[model samples]
Target: MTKKRNMWNILLASPFILAVLTCFIVNFALDRQFSWSLLTAASCLYAYLMLYTLIFGGKHRILFTYLVLAILLIPFLYIIEYTANLYLPQPIYWTTRLGIPVSLAWLAALAVTALLKTLTHANGFLTTGYFILAFYAAERCTNNRIDAFIGPNDSWSLSDHYPILYFSAAALFLLLGLITTAVKRSRSRA
Candidate 1:
């Protein structure tokens, strides 16, 4: 059975490997170098790993998937930055400064989602609400970091109006989650 499963895994992985190889061959043929193809290979590898984890990760599939994502994300971004630097004419070296922080922000969102799931032990609605809120925070962090990277705009006011919209959406979702949880609890009691 294990042999069969391993064979199936190899069969599934074949397409991904083929695609990456094809990308590399075509890229090298066209450009006489392997710049963007490296990114393609890295992305394909990450996708395959995620798919494999979700399909065969056992009981803690989601948590394991998150772990896989966290471990691979840095290397993936490095590939992206390297590809971008090589492909672009200008020497754009923002992997350490911009990419890492943005990735960290997203990772923080994932951590919040995992924490909420473990702590609440309630329906998905509350967890989703928390996830959405965490996403908003992550986006906000990304925006701030980008602004700083792109040179602070002294002309424009620091107070951006976008946060209000995100905050309102988060608030609505939290309210809905609270109502749903309350109704579910009451129903269970009755």
Candidate 2:
């Protein structure tokens, strides 16, 4: 019975994992980059964990399980460093060990998932959106210097001059996440 149920869970969750994995793979072929892919994979992983827990059934005590899954993926970042020439190790290593660590961000995401078990409301959207935005912001802010092209020869590449866009996005998502949390709280009460 247990084995059969596990199979059912895997079968249900396989499509989401495959789609996110495909997106990560295709970003390399189409854009020649994995920075965006890394962000997507991390976001998808968070949602996957939530969905997996929901299907297999974990309640109140699954936070650490989800957190372990998040930590395991830190090593996964090495793949991006190799393929995209992004200097990921130093930032992640230093930040993870010496400071707050990326795992905390994932923990927050999972906590939100646990709080809002159903993904059919604004809370659900906010929870997934928060994870996506937070993970992306973490990646973007840690090593934000990029040589992005805006037009033919009109490039916006310098890190010094291009802090605005990334910062604004991060700030906006954070504010949204907070507002969502407040709204979710009020809804739960009523």
Candidate 3:
């Protein structure tokens, strides 16, 4: 069984290897340089890592996947910036100022997701609440980063950026989860 699983893992990895090879070959053939293929290789590596981690991560799959993402994302973004700067006509430097922070924000969101999953123990309402709250937070963080990058295109208003409805819904869902858990515990005790 272990041998078969290993074989299957190898098979799963084959496509990513093929894609990377193809990208490198095509890139070098067309451009006589290996610039763009770096991006492809980096992307394939990240994808394979995430896939492998998720598949073999067992009960801790979510946490493992999140760790893989958190660890690899910034380096991946760096590769992106390196490739873009090298290949593009003009260098629009945004990696440190925009990409990293936004990625961190999303990572924080994922952390919250993992936390919620653990906390809820598959209670649906809690998961929904956490997801909604994380989504709102990530989106708001992204918009804030963009606003910072662009530098005051228009006058900023709190209402324009914030999703009050989503926040409220998330709060409601959390309340529901708490009530449900309490009632469940009370019944179990009785």
What's the TM-score of every candidate structure? 0.87, 0.34, 0.87
Each model's RMSD to truth, in Å? 2.6, 11.3, 2.4
Top candidate (lDDT): 3
Candidate 2 overall lDDT versus native? 0.57
Clash totals, every prediction: 0, 0, 0
**lDDT tens digits by residue: candidate 2, 18-57:** 8778987898888887666775676666667666665565
Off by over 4 Å in 2: 57-190
The parts of candidate 1 lying over 4 Å away from their true place are 154-159
Residue-level lDDT for 48 in candidate 1: 94
lDDT for each residue of candidate 1 in 40-139, tens digit (9 for 90 to 100): 8999999999889988899988888988899999898888888888858897878788888998999999898878878887467677778877988887
